[model samples]
Target: MSWDLSFMFDDLLPALLVGLQYTVLSTVLGYLIALLLGLLIAVVRRVRVVGPVAHGIMEFIRTTPLLIQLVFVFTLVPPTVTPLTVGVVVLGVHYAAYTAEVYRSGIEGVAKGQWEAARALSLPLRRTWGAIVLPQAIRKVIPALGNYLIAMFKDTPLLFAIGVTEMLMMAQRVGQPAGRVMEAYTLVGIMFLLVSIPSAILIRRLERRYAAV
Candidate 1:
């Protein structure tokens, strides 16, 4: 039997589009959270007073499986009357933990003289970070951060397990009854590549631009 692309375009497209919207939203929001939280965590790690706390937090997050954390947030926590807002928050928090280490490495890679110069000026803590350290650290790490963003985007599909219907879930819905699993799955993969590949290229260009500066 022949597979009909027309049927997919006519019927399944709407569901896929909706799912794609959610996927995009989740990734964007999650990345925003990751960026701010990760930087804060990195800064904390750098400060000797908070170093132990930062180390413990990082170790816990890195050692745990994300899937298990997802289940706990979605399933078990709801019994205490917490909303699914908590679940999505957990998802963002968990990923932010991973991203934090990425940021820490970036910050630590900066020259010690930079921090010393900022201190020598007697600049306020926030101003020092805002003016000097962060600019250099973040610029140097843009490529690595971009890679994390891509991974986070792909991981959005796992939200389906918690009843958040995303791209992969849409593919399953489209393919299950029609028995066009290959076609539906293939289409989803193509769409992901279409979105991710260009972003990755742009990130590489950014890396080069920042590196040149």
Candidate 2:
């Protein structure tokens, strides 16, 4: 049949809006986790303070498939817990692997002279990282981190697989009664563009700003 979005606007809009709310919330929480965990991993790698163990952990995460990680987090955990929280946490942890690499590049982008200067000043490791290293690293990585955030936003639809009822799932549910799967799915696509396009633009602006710094 022809694509008619009236059903989506009339009936599914409310539910879709709710789904978007959950999507935004999940993205935010996951982003915070990605940022902190990524920065920590990057710092550990940069200092080489943790030696082989840190390298091993980073390599393991990098090498492994994130979908497998998602499955483990979803099915291996206690079933009593809410899937929404678990989904967000799973997304966070899975993407943190990618974020760790982004952070490492940012950290490495810092000039060697900066590290030498910090060392010569007798700066403590913590102070050097906190005051000198991380500032530059984070500034450099904001665009990359923003990319991860956008990726995480897109992945929120995957939460539907775990029964989180995100946008794609909502569209599927709504389409069943109307037999308008094409319209519903197309609407979902447009909605994603609505959100993701602006996000991408903002990320580009942020990249320009970071580059200027």
lDDT of 2 by residue, 52-118 (tens): 6766876787678666666677797898988788887877777787888888887888899999999
CA RMSD for every model?
2.3, 1.9
TM-score winner: 2
lDDT, candidates in the order shown: 0.79, 0.82
**What is candidate 1's lDDT per residue for 36-95, written digit by digit as tens?**
888888888878889789879878977898777777767766455433354356667777
The model with the greatest lDDT is 2
Give the range where candidate 2 is weakest over 10 consecutive residues by summed lDDT: 43-52
Count clashing residue pairs in model 1.
Answer: 0
lDDT of 2 at 84: 83
Query: What's the true lDDT of residue 88 in model 1?
Result: 54
